[model samples]
Target chain A: MSYDFYMPVRVLGGESVVKTQAQRLREFGECCLIVTGGSGAKNSGALQDTQDALHSVGVAFEVFDRIEQNPQTETCRQAGEVARRCGADFLIGIGGGSALDATKAVAVFAANPELSADDIYKMQLSASPLPTVGIGTTAGTGSEVSGVSVLTDTKGVKHSIKGEQVYFKLVLADWRYTASCPYSVTVSTALDAFMHAAEGWLGPKCGEAPTAFAVMCLPILWKELKRMYKTQELPDSEQRKRLYHASLNAGFTLNQCGTLFPHQTGYILTEHYGVPHGRA
Target chain B: MSYDFYMPVRVLGGESVVKTQAQRLREFGECCLIVTGGSGAKNSGALQDTQDALHSVGVAFEVFDRIEQNPQTETCRQAGEVARRCGADFLIGIGGGSALDATKAVAVFAANPELSADDIYKMQLSASPLPTVGIGTTAGTGSEVSGVSVLTDTKGVKHSIKGEQVYFKLVLADWRYTASCPYSVTVSTALDAFMHAAEGWLGPKCGEAPTAFAVMCLPILWKELKRMYKTQELPDSEQRKRLYHASLNAGFTLNQCGTLFPHQTGYILTEHYGVPHGRA
Candidate 1:
């Protein structure tokens, strides 16, 4: 009967949107911290595209390439230190869920350097985090358009921080990043996107806006998933584009209504069974 | 293939949302100018609910109830002068499309008193306009959710001023307002909502978010339209609520993609042929 709605992030999608929208990165600041995983962003050429875009705009950037799966709090703190040392004014997260999630925490810790990682999970930040932009290299987590950041703590417990302050100011979704993903990785990630839309649609908190997002996303995801299952291969560029946009829609819906029991229960599968996040 | 998306306005719908959401109005301002048509808001009890809510919060307000169908520039200027004299800080638009449209213009002129009505249409104001809250008493026009204000000029031509600046910060939609609307008005307005969704879906400028909106809206509008045509009488409260929400969805879609040729060509039907906008 009652709900508050806002999806303030601007999402740009298509082939080469990252390069096309490079000029917009200047709005964040003059200097940037590019956060990525071990080899995903680099191998996929997403990092190069981002770097080239920043270079074209006359903006300088430093890369923090050590973000890991289910990004650890310690890793975020380490990345934040690098960002602080580089005097980076903004952050561009250029990999999958882990990098994007870690970037939000890193942006916060980088802005509030005096605070420890535990303090981030325990207390609300008084200071605004550095403006962060998401260059989504994968379509699974929908993290590019979400404000929620899940990071594993020192005790191996996963904790999440969420608020409007943590959302990326802009998102660049480039489907080419998924072109390099292993079939298992691609299926799992695409399933996660489907789960988000399904859960959001059935969730009690689901309202008109979120429902619209779910309705838009699920069909596209279903079509792409069907094609992927039939071909037993990676989708063509056009199909990937549909899947990419569908994932963004699901992420936006999740941002509004959140995931239901599956997300919480699925964590056990991820931690205990060594399942990939999307598979879990 | 490419798009920019934002529909940040919070829409509260149902029978008593104005009274239920009275406290939220405080976010707009303390002192307010309430704008409306001659009798729509009053006869529908929407004005009284608004007054009760403002009184509960101790917010002061003045009413300008002279807005006509296809709101005029001169009327808006006069209302702006009254608002200026009263030292109102924000505006509450509480009637149909014309009142809501006029309120947007009044807010702009009230903030920038130096500008003439012609100037309001001819040039964008350098300063931001007063914050506006819309309490939609009718289901058509979607003015409550849109930034475009269609105002008739001194030459009697309808000119629109549109931008993010004119968008309402909040919208309160009470189907009770449409409870009093004649079946013809209800059907016509509902048709207008349908046209927006259809046109937006088919438009060349349409993108993912707008297409999502059009998809969500068109079905609800069609169902409501079918019910109205069969009943040939005012709908029950539940039906009215569905129609109102559908109209708001249509308005949101229109805000995103805008109406293509039908809206522009339909203006002639409204202006010269005496057709209701939805029918046109």
Candidate 2:
């Protein structure tokens, strides 16, 4: 009968939200760092839109596009060094979970250059992290709404750095960004989103807020998954929009109740067997 | 297919949340002004709990308990003057809709003393409003979560002052506070909560988020309303908790989609015919 709610992220959804709402970026500062992985951001059109928005708002930016799958802490530290050298006032992450997770870590590293790669997990930061804006290109991770960032250490172990500080200051969620996902990626990510909703629904921490989010998303995910299972066809634009919105709802559930055994176990398969995190 | 979500209030729920989460108040500042209507706050035990919490945190406070039903803008202005004179850092509103609504105006007036009461509706403020903490003693108004505040003007017309600036910084939603309500107030407030969900559900702006909230709260409200219709009895503590939670979910819907014709017409009944706001 009791529940707590504290989502502070300002999420703007719709078509061309990034360009239309670009002025919101000025609240962070003048200079910016754009963080992403190879090809995904550029191919999805999120990166171009973000750059255009930054240009339209007259803000300067630097692009760091070397992040890889299961983002490594050292790579994030390197990006942080670049951000510090370039005097970036904020960071905009424009890809899937890996890129967004690395962006959160990079913000911390950029703000506290003295902190080594391992220091982020210690949960102590001498200065506040740079503000972060998340433009999600994948429907699966729901990392845009979550403060938790799962990253790989130098030893190749998947670990999570999580707290209120890592939550995005703003999220520009355009389902069109996910239109570029291939069939396999689309199915895998939708499965991941389903698991997020399912796990959170079953968890002991599931309360009124989480239950509401789960109820809202489960039917949408179930219908899409059923269609995918039966047809083995790529989703149309309208279906893609539904899946993206469902994932966002699942993200809200995950943000509240968190995931259980499957998510924890999935990370192991991702690290050892090279399975996609969602498929794992 | 398009939506925007931006609720920034940190809501802490459950019994005795005020005492348990008092440390959050420190984030606002060293001193506070406690605003309320006379006996409802005292009867609900919210005022005493707030005082104890403030004392425990070594934060000084002043109590301004003069707010009345359909609270006047001038009264809010006078309270703001008191707050300004005392150099209060924040405002804690405890009571139903009127008191909480007044607290929002007081925050603005306290910050911008030069602005007359009429100027609040103009949506201009020279200074940033003081942070507000809302403690709901009644379930109906949902002012704890909403940014809009309805006030009575000098000419006795009802006007609403609203924007992101008026949103509460924190909301302590302890359902037990409603346990002291009499049967009449309880039924009236429950009806108001139900109307909020219904109006928002039917509104054009009822997107996924608001629709989800409406779905979650509607069934609970229906069951309670039906029970009240059949049985001429007051709700027990457990039922009270359910009702309060339903009201909060409805509040989220109202926050997102807002109200429609019935709410606009209800204001007229309350203003001219002396109807209770919820009943109106």
Candidate 3:
């Protein structure tokens, strides 16, 4: 027996991947926490499509559509209670990492209940969580690709849920969902993905999982994310997939070695000032 | 909120990592199922150390000690039942990928009995497993870094359990453990990690997250695994860490793009004749 690795979520990212995957999600969980970015998913018709998919699956769900940027601990706790009360067997963290992180914490908290926000730190008694699936409307965060759920605590302390058990059971990446993203979001998220790769490469414990591959892909992400930030015309999946792959690598390495320098030090920025979780 | 990318297992490899990590396992699951190779971890004293670790944590465990090379479906099913009957909350797939993969499947079957070995290949599913921790005494397979769990079905068809849910919460790697690895297994597994990097680079999905970094790390793993196979004395964590890092990248890349022609074609070789799953 060797070591184990987990990413149980079935990820599908493309034009039709959302609907196709929604069909699959129907068979699995109970009520979902249909997390959205304030109101975009509702307005963009993606929410309607998602609802349509849920209806097709015949699964009941409620939306925690009010998740704000850089979700606060209070919000996650509220979501947790809702999930617990709703008897939500499965959680769908449908928006970006904010909602997703909230979904992760809420699912775990709802299932276990005893673990408060305080227990989520690196050293504390923690249990496995309720099953979850992610839908990426943006390509950054790569929350879909990792197990660490970064959330801002009430005191604004960024707490990261560092176990693989928190990885989403499914990550549906519909590039089309991200296509209409505000230009600012695209650049920032892509930059965040690049950072995941860069930090992973530079991190102290970067293991032999193949660091060179991650390094090589860095330039591509750097160039392209920058280009999209400036040009705004998106790269096709073939091109974008490279960075996605790199982001995943970055996630793997960083998760192993952990984020070095900027990431570790960035907490000061987030905690002291009012910097957003992703930017700092 | 953008995507958050990461490979979630916290790895502690190089010589004394198992012993070092044993302290932390107390924070892992309550009960662990020590999944081992056909007596390899025992002979190496790794099993004894693991036992000591569990005992120190005041944790309890049972061993599934009969895992074989190129582990088959029956092993997983049987082990899964054993784990279920034992009510094991945590599992330690303690040797290489065979034991690890089998242990992963067993955890899955133990959690969700309805899904058969055959169902995994068609699509990724919830392998509802207890929190699993993998300790790699051997650095091949890259199983520590991947969620792809492969097992031969009843007809000897190699099926894979793919997704994040099966990933280990923590991966403890101690190069010292490899001190007793048979020269050949060491060679093959190292080569396998090498192939994982090479093939992942060549595959179509090389464009995904951190593939560049993963791609770049290949040679380092190739170089060290080869040297380790030849000399068996590369205790320098710096060097071994490089290989470990490369393998992690390769694992991430392969998980995304998978092996290209070689992996696809190798399946036929196994199906028609009888090539070992790792034999390239």
Candidate 4:
């Protein structure tokens, strides 16, 4: 009958998310790192738009646009070096999980120079907490709201540093921003989200709060994952709203419950096939 | 998407709740105001036990032992003035929602000296927020985690100040304490939980989070409420946990999508008739 449930990742949902990036960014320190990959965020003008938002807020930033799919811990090491060199105090992970995952590790390393790619790979290092926020241009991963940052090692084995107690500081979920994702990427993320919702429900021995969170999120995601498979584009507004919230709830669910085996097992596509992390 | 949700009142579940009472009281204020009715918390030693917790934590206190069914605003104001004279910084609402509701208003009126019992009838006075926490003694109302306070005015008009925002700084929900609520109280509160789940499922503009909250809570409550009705008590630990979690999810649901007319209409029980707030 008694439990403490708190989500430090202040979640802001919907269309106005684009406009609030700057204000959200200001919640962290001024010097920032923008983690991105390929063309998604840049093409949607999301990358530039985010820079503009932070610029208006008077935050200085540097861009490490070399993040890649199934981000390797080495990429994280590089990003951290960039953050250190640029004196960035905070990170804005601006694409899908790859970019965000990269930023998450970079944040870990920005504070602890002694920890290398291998240390993070083994999840054996300790580092001071770093603030992170996300604006996903994709609907899958739910990375914008999760505490996990998955990366690959030089041996091509995948590793994850799960400091769930230290999750994102803010998550801005804008379905509209994700509308422009290619059909395949959208499908990949949607399936990943689908897996996350169901598995999250069955996986964790979570409390009433997180159990309630799963119940709320599952049906909506099941419905939207279907719709996304059909329309191959932005879902209807109602569905968009539904999926968007599902993503947030799913994030909250898995964040609390931890993911189930299917979700964990689903990551094979990334490790073996070079597919996006969301290819569940 | 821009919706705001916070339960500043921290919660500690299980027998451990007794251990936190003192620290919670000190955090609440230097002097504590205990609000309750039906003598259950007192009889069960929950009241004395909590006082012992607070005493160990070095907190001072007083009690309003006369809170009645439905919790009249008159009682609230009286308790408020008592709090004022006592210079209490925090209120501990023991027992069910009546005590919780009355305590909420008591804290409010104590904070805003200009308000009177009549102001509640007109819904005219704005009271400042004060710290509050609850010992659910009964599992109904979801009041422990919600930002609402309901009271009946002298003229038999029931009113609520939703966003009093501070009812308790910490909620101690010990299922063992819920063991003492009467059969009728159990039925009504469980229905209140069911109504919350049903309403949230179909509620206006609710998100995946609340939707998920409804789904997980509803099925468990539907089953548990029936069991409680048939047996007049939770028959086992599993059923007890189910009911306890359901009660919490019910509160979480209200925290997000707020109950529609049916639940809100229940407030009229205190206003239109003499039904105890719990029975109505």
Candidate 5:
């Protein structure tokens, strides 16, 4: 069997990993653009922690908080313009898949301002994207460790921009952020993580490494899901961490093998029915 | 629960994949240098096929076929000089571990001639190594998909040079090549591959992805080992392919988790007792 595997995104995860790991942001330049959806990053305290980390490192930063579910292509371009205006050297995406996905497109535009939204969808660009950091607040999507961006065009058609170019330079994931998430959001997102592993495990592109990721993740996620469903509350901190890392592992699998029919079909629900990105 | 994983190699397997995939060589550059050790490549017909593929694509290349087992630093430097003198833009490694390992070091020197052997060992290079393509002639050493080079110094002490710079851009693995390997060599190499999986599976650095690779490889290697031990002759071509791919999978595991005490201790047996690399 012949196959290909690659995942360049560096991930640091745990309870307080964001505080400890955010120091790596120094590897990117001096200024930063923090991207997030409505109130997720703020509510989770991830935004404050990230700001503190940047402040401690004496790096300048600006926050762009307009990202919405099923991030819009136009919003990403506007964020890119903000980054360019502020002379932001890098980007930090904090929140769920929408925020993280939007950051990738924003970085691409910030790096090449001449490129249009259509150019981005077409994937025509002259330079590499600015370095980006992803700090996930949700337990699914695994966007923190993926090089894929799902954005909706003005026509409400979802478009995916993928490849190595979109891979985040660093990913800081703290499981505690999901502790405050709503039950429905938590369960749906967790299910999305499950599907990533289950589908990837059975996919035609499955390889030894990806299967290992699946084997390791499926058990942890299943156990946590069972506990959450029975208790109707989030699992303990330890289990929460396990679920979060399991999602990251599944993301790594998807990075190599990619998803099959389910992901493609899920996109339709997300775009039309307004289903949450993870639930769809 | 958090670990970093990355493997950028694109692998193409099958009896004639080398010829089919060599067209990708043009992506690296105009001219190339083919690195090999002894007659392994010629005996397996891999070198001729590689040359024909390059010729068909009209890419100029030169052969530097003087690598020795347990590749030496001096020899690699010499090969690098040959590559630079020939104006080779990229490198094709076509043999067993020694040749593939040497190609990595040679590519390093060819790109930055100012650096010495000491600099390479210290990873004090000025620029990235040239792109590399690996073709395996042995079922052992998954060097085709890894960016690790184990070279011996003048003191006869084995030193390992590893980094992202050494990762092959493309890997062409064909099980048919190992069909020509002698019984002793084949068994030894296969055992070495087994050790890679076993040790990596048990290492402290072991992660989900690496464990998955080990899980897939261990069973295949075990079954093949039982058969090889039972009969003096090589297994059928199909089994050989399985064994070869298993070795590559083990290599992927080692690339992430790395080997432990066994690999460290095996070096001594190879250096002192003159045991073959895999047997030791």
Candidate 6:
């Protein structure tokens, strides 16, 4: 009976989605900042495609590749300063959860230079955050469509900055980008996507819309997980595409109902034990 | 595989939703216009609640109630002129499909005064349409969340003006508003909602998101539709609420997949044969 559905992100999925829909990026502004982790964007070929699209559309750009695993708030602040100094009008995030999540915080800082890194959690801003375009290279994070950004503070504690303001304005979901994931990373990210769907499905807040997304995604993730469990093999291209899209569906579920016990406890293992977020 | 999802309307649903969420109206601007059919808005008590909410928020307003069944382009143009003269910043649409559909066209005309009534179909505007708030008093149409507006042209031909431009900025869905519908209206509107779900379920364009919405709403609609066939009685308050919500779910489905044969042919019957849209 819960009929409150309100996700505003526009998602376009296909092969070479960025190339086909590059004109959409121009709507944000003439110049941009591209944010990513050290290697995922290059490894997945998303960086090349994003640059090509921007070049074709005649949009000037710069890259900030310092975001790490469990993104640090101070790092995001530095990237924001870079964007402001370069006069970048919008931000393009290309990578997994960490890089994309950092991009959200960077956008807030970029728009509000007066606020320090820690002030992001306080949620006080004189101006709205810069609009973000997310090009997700990994299948697990769902950060492309979600507003929740988990960032490590100066104390090394993980706190989330969440609200409608942080949601990406556009998401170019190309499953081809996920085909490059190594075996362990693939397994871990698949687990993360599965956990997202499972937690939302079991959560008290799961309503009609969230339940529909969960139902649509859980079976897809289950089939892939079962195959991987039996074979100990990396998914084929078709399976990779399915997994990537399933992760997006799971993201929609998680976006609506949010995470439950596992996510809360998983952060602890990630922070202290050097565990990857999904595996933890 | 079709992973394009982009509906931006924010929907809030529950009993007395308007009164509880009245403050949201203030975000649009200082002054507004309310558009509706003659009695549905008043009889449903949505008008009084809307007025009270607007007054409480200190947002000035005016009402235009001349819209009739299968809204005409000329009528909407006139309403837009009224809104322009009054200096209304935004528009609130209350009632069934006709009123809601007219409001969408009125929004376009209000922002583009130089364009004649027939020019709306051409989809040309120097500026974006005014933001719209849709309050549904009927279980059918789903116009609150959709961007397609079916308006009669100068030749009395029913052509649709569609795109993201016509989408409402916000939607307040109170099932209580639908409780006032009599037996015939209840039956017809329910059938219209059923047709939307069924058509989208069967359509070739029905993708994962649309199918999820179709699956969620189909059973609820089927149960009520079957009961109505056997009992031939009006639905109680609880049933009315269920039906109203089911229609919204169906609306989500229709908004994504759109209608096929029935909707195209049904308009002909409605325009020429004087048959009610749903029954046709």
lDDT of 6: 0.91
DockQ of each: 0.43, 0.76, 0.19, 0.25, 0.49, 0.81
Q: Check candidate 1 and list the clashing pairs.
A: none
Q: Which candidate, 1 or 3, would have the higher lDDT against the true structure? A: 1
Off by over 4 Å in 5: none
DockQ sort, best first: 6, 2, 5, 1, 4, 3
> How well does candidate 6 match the true structure in TM-score terms?
0.96
> Of the candidates numbered 1 and 6, which has the greater TM-score value?
6
The reply for model 3, stretches above 4 Å from the true place, is A1-11, A42-45, A74-87, A105-130, A142-167, A190-217, A225-280, B1-11, B24-39, B58-134, B137-139, B142-170, B181-185, B196-217, B221-280
Worst 10 residues of 3 chain A by lDDT: A1-10
Candidate 4 residue spans exceeding 4 A from truth: A1-5, A8-12, A15-39, A45-93, A98-134, A147-170, A191-195, A212-245, A259-280, B1-35, B52-68, B72-91, B103-131, B152-157, B167-170, B219-240
Candidate whose DockQ is highest? 6
Quote model 5's TM-score. 0.94
Candidate 6: chain B TM-score equals 0.98
Question: How high a TM-score does candidate 1 get?
Answer: 0.89
Query: Candidate 6 chain B, which ten residues in sequence have the lowest lDDT sum?
Result: B201-210
What would the DockQ be for model 5? 0.49
Using lDDT as the measure, the top candidate is 6
The residue-level lDDT of candidate 1 at B122 comes to 63
B34-134 per-residue lDDT for model 2 (tens digits): 99997989999999999999999999999999999999999999999999999899999999999999999999999999978778888688899999999
lDDT of 6 by residue, B71-169 (tens): 999999999999999999999999999999999999999999998989999988998999999999999777888879999998888999999899999
**Could you tell me how far off, in angstroms, the CA of residue A263 lies in candidate 5 after the best superposition?**
2.9
CA lDDT of A169 in candidate 2? 90
Cα lDDT tens digits for candidate 6, A1-280: 5667788998889898999999999888999999999699999999999999999999999999999999999999999999999999999999999999999999999999998889999989999999999999888888887879999999999999999899999999999899888888888998999999899889887777878888998999999989988999989988998999899889988988889989989999999998999999
Show the lowest summed lDDT stretch of 10 residues, model 4 chain B.
Answer: B1-10
* Candidate 2's DockQ: 0.76
Which has the higher lDDT value, candidate number 3 or candidate number 4? 4
Q: How well does candidate 1 score on lDDT at residue B78? A: 89
